[model samples]
Target: MSESKALCTDTELFAAALFQLQVSVWERTADDIPVRVEDGGTIERITPVSVKINGIYYVRSECEFRVDRSGIKS
Candidate 1:
Protein backbone atom coordinates (compact mmCIF):
# COMPACT_ATOMS: atom_id res chain seq x y z
CA MET A 1 0.00 0.00 0.00
CA SER A 2 1.06 3.54 -0.71
CA GLU A 3 1.36 6.02 2.08
CA SER A 4 0.28 9.65 1.82
CA LYS A 5 0.70 12.73 3.98
CA ALA A 6 -0.43 16.31 3.93
CA LEU A 7 2.38 18.53 2.74
CA CYS A 8 3.92 20.22 5.71
CA THR A 9 6.08 22.56 3.70
CA ASP A 10 6.39 23.87 0.14
CA THR A 11 10.11 23.05 -0.10
CA GLU A 12 9.52 19.41 0.81
CA LEU A 13 6.59 18.91 -1.55
CA PHE A 14 8.45 20.59 -4.42
CA ALA A 15 11.37 18.21 -4.07
CA ALA A 16 9.10 15.15 -4.29
CA ALA A 17 6.86 15.66 -7.30
CA LEU A 18 6.21 18.02 -10.20
CA PHE A 19 3.12 20.12 -9.61
CA GLN A 20 0.97 21.62 -12.36
CA LEU A 21 -1.52 24.13 -11.06
CA GLN A 22 -3.94 26.37 -12.93
CA VAL A 23 -5.96 29.15 -11.34
CA SER A 24 -7.99 32.27 -11.94
CA VAL A 25 -7.04 35.80 -10.94
CA TRP A 26 -8.55 39.27 -10.80
CA GLU A 27 -7.27 42.82 -11.11
CA ARG A 28 -7.42 45.31 -8.25
CA THR A 29 -8.60 48.77 -9.01
CA ALA A 30 -9.88 51.69 -6.98
CA ASP A 31 -11.47 53.58 -9.85
CA ASP A 32 -13.88 52.06 -12.39
CA ILE A 33 -11.50 52.56 -15.31
CA PRO A 34 -8.10 50.97 -16.14
CA VAL A 35 -4.78 52.83 -16.09
CA ARG A 36 -2.12 52.65 -18.79
CA VAL A 37 0.69 54.10 -16.73
CA GLU A 38 3.53 51.56 -16.91
CA ASP A 39 5.91 53.52 -14.72
CA GLY A 40 3.25 54.06 -12.10
CA GLY A 41 2.15 51.60 -9.43
CA THR A 42 0.16 48.55 -10.46
CA ILE A 43 -3.57 48.35 -9.85
CA GLU A 44 -3.37 44.63 -9.23
CA ARG A 45 -1.20 42.23 -7.28
CA ILE A 46 0.56 39.79 -9.58
CA THR A 47 -0.87 36.24 -9.47
CA PRO A 48 -3.20 37.15 -6.67
CA VAL A 49 -5.20 34.23 -5.24
CA SER A 50 -8.81 34.94 -6.13
CA VAL A 51 -10.02 31.32 -6.03
CA LYS A 52 -9.50 28.07 -4.20
CA ILE A 53 -9.85 24.37 -5.05
CA ASN A 54 -10.86 21.52 -2.77
CA GLY A 55 -9.82 22.22 0.83
CA ILE A 56 -6.68 24.14 -0.04
CA TYR A 57 -6.13 27.72 1.00
CA TYR A 58 -3.79 29.72 -1.20
CA VAL A 59 -2.18 32.26 1.05
CA ARG A 60 0.42 34.60 -0.45
CA SER A 61 2.92 31.93 -1.41
CA GLU A 62 0.33 29.64 -3.01
CA CYS A 63 -0.79 32.45 -5.30
CA GLU A 64 2.44 32.15 -7.26
CA PHE A 65 3.34 28.95 -9.13
CA ARG A 66 7.02 29.09 -8.17
CA VAL A 67 8.68 31.30 -5.62
CA ASP A 68 11.26 31.95 -8.30
CA ARG A 69 9.15 32.45 -11.43
CA SER A 70 12.04 34.00 -13.34
CA GLY A 71 14.12 30.80 -13.26
CA ILE A 72 11.21 28.39 -13.54
CA LYS A 73 9.65 27.60 -16.88
CA SER A 74 6.25 26.46 -15.50
Candidate 2:
Protein backbone atom coordinates (compact mmCIF):
# COMPACT_ATOMS: atom_id res chain seq x y z
CA MET A 1 0.00 0.00 0.00
CA SER A 2 1.21 3.51 -0.80
CA GLU A 3 0.05 6.95 0.28
CA SER A 4 0.41 10.08 -1.78
CA LYS A 5 0.66 13.51 -0.24
CA ALA A 6 0.20 16.78 -2.03
CA LEU A 7 2.16 19.82 -1.06
CA CYS A 8 0.88 23.36 -1.20
CA THR A 9 3.15 26.38 -1.65
CA ASP A 10 2.59 29.82 -0.21
CA THR A 11 1.29 31.11 -3.49
CA GLU A 12 -1.16 28.21 -3.82
CA LEU A 13 -2.40 28.71 -0.30
CA PHE A 14 -2.78 32.43 -0.89
CA ALA A 15 -4.68 31.76 -4.11
CA ALA A 16 -7.12 29.47 -2.30
CA ALA A 17 -7.57 32.01 0.45
CA LEU A 18 -8.20 34.75 -2.09
CA PHE A 19 -10.84 32.65 -3.83
CA GLN A 20 -12.61 31.93 -0.57
CA LEU A 21 -12.48 35.60 0.35
CA GLN A 22 -13.90 36.65 -2.99
CA VAL A 23 -16.80 34.25 -2.58
CA SER A 24 -17.54 35.65 0.85
CA VAL A 25 -17.33 39.20 -0.42
CA TRP A 26 -19.68 38.48 -3.29
CA GLU A 27 -22.22 36.83 -0.99
CA ARG A 28 -22.15 39.79 1.39
CA THR A 29 -22.33 42.20 -1.49
CA ALA A 30 -25.39 40.45 -2.89
CA ASP A 31 -27.11 40.86 0.46
CA ASP A 32 -25.96 44.47 0.83
CA ILE A 33 -26.80 45.80 -2.62
CA PRO A 34 -30.57 45.57 -2.27
CA VAL A 35 -30.49 47.26 1.10
CA ARG A 36 -28.37 50.07 -0.28
CA VAL A 37 -30.67 50.44 -3.25
CA GLU A 38 -33.69 50.53 -0.97
CA ASP A 39 -32.02 53.32 0.95
CA GLY A 40 -31.43 55.19 -2.32
CA GLY A 41 -27.76 54.56 -2.59
CA THR A 42 -26.20 54.02 -5.98
CA ILE A 43 -23.37 51.56 -6.33
CA GLU A 44 -20.31 53.06 -7.95
CA ARG A 45 -18.01 50.12 -7.89
CA ILE A 46 -16.73 47.22 -5.83
CA THR A 47 -13.02 46.90 -5.68
CA PRO A 48 -10.80 44.23 -4.19
CA VAL A 49 -7.28 44.84 -3.05
CA SER A 50 -4.74 42.15 -2.26
CA VAL A 51 -2.13 42.68 0.39
CA LYS A 52 0.79 40.33 0.73
CA ILE A 53 3.03 39.66 3.69
CA ASN A 54 5.86 37.17 3.82
CA GLY A 55 4.65 35.77 0.49
CA ILE A 56 1.07 35.22 1.69
CA TYR A 57 -1.77 37.44 0.50
CA TYR A 58 -5.24 38.46 1.63
CA VAL A 59 -8.00 40.45 0.00
CA ARG A 60 -9.78 43.57 1.12
CA SER A 61 -13.08 44.67 -0.36
CA GLU A 62 -14.12 48.28 -0.93
CA CYS A 63 -17.67 49.17 -1.85
CA GLU A 64 -18.22 52.67 -3.19
CA PHE A 65 -21.68 54.16 -2.97
CA ARG A 66 -23.26 57.32 -4.31
CA VAL A 67 -26.39 58.88 -2.86
CA ASP A 68 -29.24 59.68 -5.18
CA ARG A 69 -30.29 63.33 -5.12
CA SER A 70 -33.90 62.48 -5.90
CA GLY A 71 -34.08 60.27 -2.87
CA ILE A 72 -32.95 63.06 -0.60
CA LYS A 73 -35.55 65.28 1.04
CA SER A 74 -34.94 68.91 1.95
Please, what is the whole-model Cα lDDT of each candidate in the order they appear?
A: 0.30, 0.29
Off by over 4 Å in 2: 1-7, 21-74
Q: Estimate the overall C-alpha local distance difference test score of candidate 2.
A: 0.29
- The TM-scores of all predictions, comma-separated, are 0.20, 0.20
- Backbone clashes in model 2, listed as residue pairs: none
Model 1 misplacement above 4 A: 18-74
- The 10 consecutive residues of candidate 2 with the worst lDDT sum are 34-43
Considering summed lDDT, which 10 consecutive residues are worst modelled in model 1? 36-45
RMSD of each: 14.9, 19.6
Q: What is the lDDT of residue 54 in candidate 1?
A: 35
Per-residue accuracy of model 2 over 17-72 as CA lDDT, tens digit each: 44332111111364465222122212222224543322333343332222222333
Per-residue CA lDDT of model 1 for 1-74, tens digit only, reads 32223333545234322433222222225764433222111112222332233333344443322222332343
